[model samples]
Target: MSLKQQLKDAVAKQKKARDITREDIVKNAAAIQRSRQEQKDLSNRPH
Candidate 1:
C-alpha cells in the first residue's frame, strides 16, 4: 500500500479509540514531507 494510504489507515485506527484532529494529520504530513526532502537532499550531495 502507498504511504498516504498507510497514514490514513493509521489515523482511522486511532480514531476508533480516541480523538484525532485534522491538525494532527496536517502536522504529520508536513513532517513526512520535510523528512523526505531531507533524504533527497542528502542523496544529491557529494560523497
Candidate 2:
C-alpha cells in the first residue's frame, strides 16, 4: 500500500513477538527511507 503502511509492516515483521521501541521504529524508517533514496539515485544514473 502506502509508504506509511509499508513502514508499519516492516516494523511488525521485525517485531516477531518482541517488543518494539520508538527508537527501533525510527531506525527502521530511516533505513527504509535511505534505501529508497539510493534506489532512486541508481535508477537516475546514465548507465
Candidate 3:
C-alpha cells in the first residue's frame, strides 16, 4: 500500500528471481560438464 512497502516487495522479488537464475546456471553448467565427460568416454572406447 505504501511506497516504501512497494519498493521493498520489488526488491525481494528481484532477489528471488536472481537466486533462481543462479540455480539454473549452476544446473546447466553441471549438465554440460557431465555431457563433456560422457563424450570423452565415448571417444576413448573402441569401435
Candidate 4:
C-alpha cells in the first residue's frame, strides 16, 4: 500500500483500539462500583 494508505490504516487501527480500551475501562469501573456497593451492603446487614 502507498504511504498515505498506510497512514490511514494505522490511524484507523489506533482509533479502534482506543474505542475498545475506553469500553473496557467503563465496564471495569462499573464492575468495581457494583462490588463496592455489595460489600457495603453486606457489612450493613445484620449477622
Candidate 5:
C-alpha cells in the first residue's frame, strides 16, 4: 500500500473510534476560533 493509502486507512479507523462527524469538528473549530478572535480584539483595544 502507498503512504497516502495508509494514512487514509488510519484516518478511517480513528474516525470510527471517535465517531466524530465533520460538522462536529467544524462547529468546535469555529467556536474556538471565535473565542480566540474575541480575546485578541479585547487585548488590542485602546488602553
Candidate 6:
C-alpha cells in the first residue's frame, strides 16, 4: 500500500472515533438534564 492510503485510513478511523465520542457526550448531557429536572420537581413538593 502507498503512504497516502495509509494516512487516509488513519484519518478515517480517527474521525469515526471522534463521532462516537461526540454521540456519547450528547447522550450523557441529556441524561444529566433529565436528572436535574427530576431533582427540581422533587424539591418543590411538600412532605
* Higher-scoring candidate on lDDT, 2 or 6: 6
Please tell me which model should have the higher lDDT, number 2 or number 5: 5
Higher-TM-score candidate of 1 and 5: 1
Off by over 4 Å in 2: 1-20
Cα distance off (Å), candidate 5, residue 16: 10
Q: Which candidate tops TM-score? A: 4
Write the number of the candidate with greater lDDT, choosing between 1 and 3: 3
The residue-by-residue lDDT of candidate 1 on 1-47, one tens digit each, is 99999999998899864645677788899999999999999999999
Reference-based TM-score of each model: 0.56, 0.56, 0.96, 0.97, 0.53, 0.86
Per-residue lDDT of model 3, residues 1-47, tens digit only: 99999999999999999999999999999999999999999999999
Which regions of candidate 3 are displaced past 4 Å?
none
After superposing candidate 4, which stretches have Cα over 4 Å from the reference? Answer: none
Q: Give one digit per residue, the lDDT tens place, for model 4 in 1-47.
A: 99999999999999999999999999999999999999999999999
Error of 4 at 45 (Å): 0.5
Determine the backbone clash count of candidate 4.
Answer: 0
> Which is superior by lDDT, 4 or 6?
4
In candidate 1, clashing pairs total 0
Q: Model 3 lDDT vs. the true structure? A: 1.00
Reference-based lDDT, each prediction: 0.89, 0.89, 1.00, 1.00, 0.92, 0.99
> For residues 1-47, what per-residue lDDT tens digits would candidate 2 score against the true structure?
99999999998888864565767888999999999999999999999
How far is 14's C-alpha from truth in model 1 (Å)? Answer: 14
Q: How well does model 5 score by local distance difference test?
A: 0.92
The pairs that clash in candidate 5 are none
Error of 1 at 9 (Å): 27
Q: Candidate 5 residues 1-47, lDDT tens each?
A: 99999999999999886766777888999999999999999999999
Q: What value does the lDDT take at residue 9 in candidate 3?
A: 100
